[model samples]
Target: MFSRKTRLAVAIAAACSFNQALAAEQEQLELDAQTVVGSADESAVDSYRSTPSSAATKLDLTPRQTPQSISTLTRAQLDDFHLDSVNDALKMATGIQVQEVETDRTYYTARGFDITNFQYDGIGIPFVYGNVEGDIDTAVFERVEVIRGANGLMSGTGNPSATINFVRKRPTATPQARIDLTGGSWDKRRIDADVSGALTAAGNIRGRAVYAHENKNSYLDRYSREKNVFHGVLEFDLSDSTLFSIGHTLQKSDSNSPLWGALPLNFSDGSKTDYSRSTSTSADWAYWDVQENRTFAELAHDLGNGWQAKAVVTHVKKEGDGSLFYVYGTPDRDSGLGLFSYPSEYQDENRQLIGDLQLNGAFALGGRQHDAVLGASWSRSELEDISWYDTTTGTALPPLEDWSGNIGKPLNDAGSNGSDFTDRMQSFYGAARWSLTDRLSLITGARVVDVESSGGNYGSDKTTKYSGEVVPYAGVVFDLTEQYSVYASYTEVFDPQTETDASGSRLAPVEGVNYEAGIKGELFDDRVNLALAVFRTEQDNVAEMAGMVGGRSYYRAVEGLTSEGYELEISGELLPGLQAMAGYTFVDITDANDDHAVTYSPKHMFKAATTYRVPGLEQLKVGASLNWQDEVYNGIAEQDAYAVVNLMASYDIDPNWTVSANLNNLTDEKYLTSLYWTQAYYAAPRNASMSVSWKY
Candidate 1:
């Protein structure tokens, strides 16, 4: 797997070199003709609803036309809310939930299940839990798109949660530059730079680049993090009707004294620990580090006659290393001890290759205009993990005297064999939209997917395959008026299971079906949008974590799991100079036994934000936000209901200069963000940041 990745990297490098040389020569020889200038497709929107998306069906469509519950976080919104990470953006999206299972390991879910499917620019990619790929910085993205419920029509395989799509910022024909510097509580410091413009004097070639760096101390004692990222892209006009582009990104993150798990909820005698939120479970010697790289290339051609074809290729490589200690065993309140340490060290790498081609155009069918798309895609992901564990006899050191963060680090001498896993998938998909009438439309799509996974241990060697799985999707939309539309959609997806039955035989794959109906409306000349949707999902062959057997934990298959939910969202500008976004979600989950099934999925969640410009003082703006969630549980531990409020203020010194201040947890609310099976994680306390931004 490593060799394959190395070869691919070298090939891409050579291609990039050749492209650059060719571009330079073309620029020198055809300097006068290269004066034909091009502009970026992106548009600045004053309201959330002004942005159009292509994530739902891989077609340029508004949120109301997608026939599903969709939400977007625009760059303007991100700036208003001070969202720095992908996790932060998702948390603000409608009906979405995020949890920090461990330090630097955040997980996302929608409806009632974990989200495992992710896409970049409408292309599918692999996502795994406890991987830093899920928590990368969001500075390079122009916006984030989310589709609620099953999305099998576009994503070949995934859980029934939701699909998240990140749209990258494109190069601009007009020269643009921006810089920001920030200082905040907890000794936080950050700097960001973005620049985009024509690369050649004749304006035939364009380029964009983004760079960001941040270092901060955490609320938890003895924990600190540092991160740096760089992204660059170049676009060249191969001809009047063709375009070529290539991009690369590099990001690195390091967390010192990172905890493996949160503090315990109960003591050894079954008594509550009631420890302070500032308590830490990690030692100074523990750390976690991650480095990731991505390279991509694209070619698009306008075939003329209202037809176009596009091909894209992307490669991602992520490497992680960690040495950590977990504090778990029940504690003894009387003796001030009962906890034990499980120390280990590990190194892992994940590599992925994805390619897709699509031909889309408008055609006259049966005396009416229709849109159709034919596409094929191939993707593969490979992962390898190597670890060393502490093998001391008794596995118990001296108990802590006062149960502080002064635990000693143990030696990791015991060796463990490495494990490797690989997944490959190929699919053919097609979709078409028929304009039956000016007010009604019918859209249908399907994908035939062939997927296989192999590799476990060097000796054990296990494999799983699912061939010829057909996932179908359909939707209907009726325009009640120029501003209102009603729609319904049905979609399905499947996941191959790795869990085994009691007899140790692999279980069948899980299947999911989603039914949705919604009413959408656009107001203020399509500058404001609103949607009310109700959804129901059914799953068969669901996998659940089972109790330990043979001194190791395992998973089992369960049947008859259902989740029903409703979402309400309103976004965009109610009036000029005033922007707002509000959302509320309610969900209910039932298991095979007809009981409350999901422990981590909250039944109620809500988020809202608004920004207003002072009527007379056009240069001053004020904003506020609210985030609330109902109580959640993991096994016996429960996280109580919580609500937080944030406030922001900004002053535009001039057209090119601005200063802003952000205050989080305005009321200083104390809450728990996650309740894992073994421990509880607390939310951060009140914090504030001030920044100055200059744009030209």
Candidate 2:
């Protein structure tokens, strides 16, 4: 119940009714006098735009001053659109594609490449290989920031796509509380609560806590899930010029009858196969469960004379266990009897500890003042996994038209094997922003890193390490005027691969470089923002799948791959009562052979969302969002361009109470989740959710 869907007819009718909201919006207010007032860590209260962002360089800079493309999903926008999950929020974010490849595993891509770097509160990068195995809730986050293109100065291994930073909410100086209950189609039920305030009489100590729980059935037969998220943080003022903070976050999800892979997209004859959207290839005994725990501590101090020091320490643990069933083979279109099913049991555990120290301040040089930061970071991670299975594997024979999840689970204790790996990283980085003149600035950064992979993983055949690797970053910005600026940047990063070649030898790490230029501006006295950017990226030693051998899949490293793209985005208070965000992206990828490659990634994408408070009715608001992408090919088959519309409306019962409703897939559009492989699945159909919330 991705919030559960209303009955089919009801959902369609309600969604169609919302079409009027978009066409009837009146002229909005433009108050050029509105000013930004808040810390960059916190979102601007009730605004769609952000205050300032350091997502690009550790130094805080306004969007117009940054030399890269950045997008943010703020708290107010999340609440207005009912985006409670990370997947849903990223779906509407500019220039990002949320690929839900399976029931629980998802992949995110931007600018024609996969995104592998993720940050928590601007600290600790979680290393993932294009996929995340469990659901991520937004209840504990103040905002989601996306830095597109290559960013090596911060997120190590600067994958050429994008980096996602989930900023956790901090304790507030004033007391506040909120409770929400939501119900959606497919019997989806969810509850969320958030509370924050000062814990001491003198207000020297503050605490904040958030919790969310959800239970729901899916559009697919025999599929269901339960999820819970809990987060808490405490901030203490050691002195008038110093602060200390500690926090912990826990997220868990358990799913029943989840698919291991997906359905075959083609039959024996090579023609694309068609199945009902509600079809499932899962057995009743299959289940997948995952949990993530994060604990962190941070300290900050003002050293006087415009100098500051900060330190952060963090630990993360993730565990997963699954009993999965996979359907493989090219089934006959008429008989559907050529497919085979295999079942297996898997368990995995991952633990990581990371820490960093940073010192920053203002310095005067030859008649000009500038800002600079120096940092040192270290990280250690260990991973363990096991695969257990029964003996029966290639058995075939079942009628697809009359199949149900009645299969019994096989004893998985027959055999077991696994892998263990340990990895470590150490790096030193520094960056500075020099104001050469009143309208010109120069930004430069550098990182020296040493990384090693000591133990062999599931597919690796040897120990791998890279020492004394250097990543460089440079950018220059020239203000055309007080409200506009033009900038250009160059950066580099490297990524290690886990996939091996036909000889079972690990492939070389991928190295990438990027060149980008953009024009940024503010309108209506900075109430509105606009950006236009173009970028080109080149990579070497990219891993690509090769033929299988001895029951094992292998990959080969390809060199000289290129990707080029452009983007346009605008977000802010277009009017006094109207807030809006819109963006368009186009990208082209060329393989080593100089041909269009990675067809699974579309060449064009467009996303837009807007919310309006009624002019005459101050207590009511309505919003609509659209996501569209051009056709994509999986090397085997192609899917046509598709668009999904979402509508939201809310009424304030009073200052402390409100009721809201959201409808997604308004036109009941049918689409595939992804074309990554020959096996794929359909996305959920039209769905709706209604909620009641109380705030104090």
Model 1 spans > 4 angstroms off: 1-42, 128-134, 269-272, 393-410, 457-461, 497-508, 545-555
Alpha carbon lDDT at 594, candidate 1: 86
lDDT of 1: 0.78
List residue ranges in candidate 2 displaced over 4 A. 1-43, 499-505, 545-555
Instruction: Point to the candidate with the largest lDDT.
Output: 2
TM-score of 1: 0.91
Which candidate achieves the best TM-score against the true structure?
2
Clashing pairs in 1: 268-331
lDDT of 1 by residue, 546-624 (tens): 5433212245777889999899999998878889989999999998798998777789999998899889998999999
- Provide the TM-score for each candidate, comma-separated: 0.91, 0.92
Worst 10 residues of 1 by lDDT: 545-554
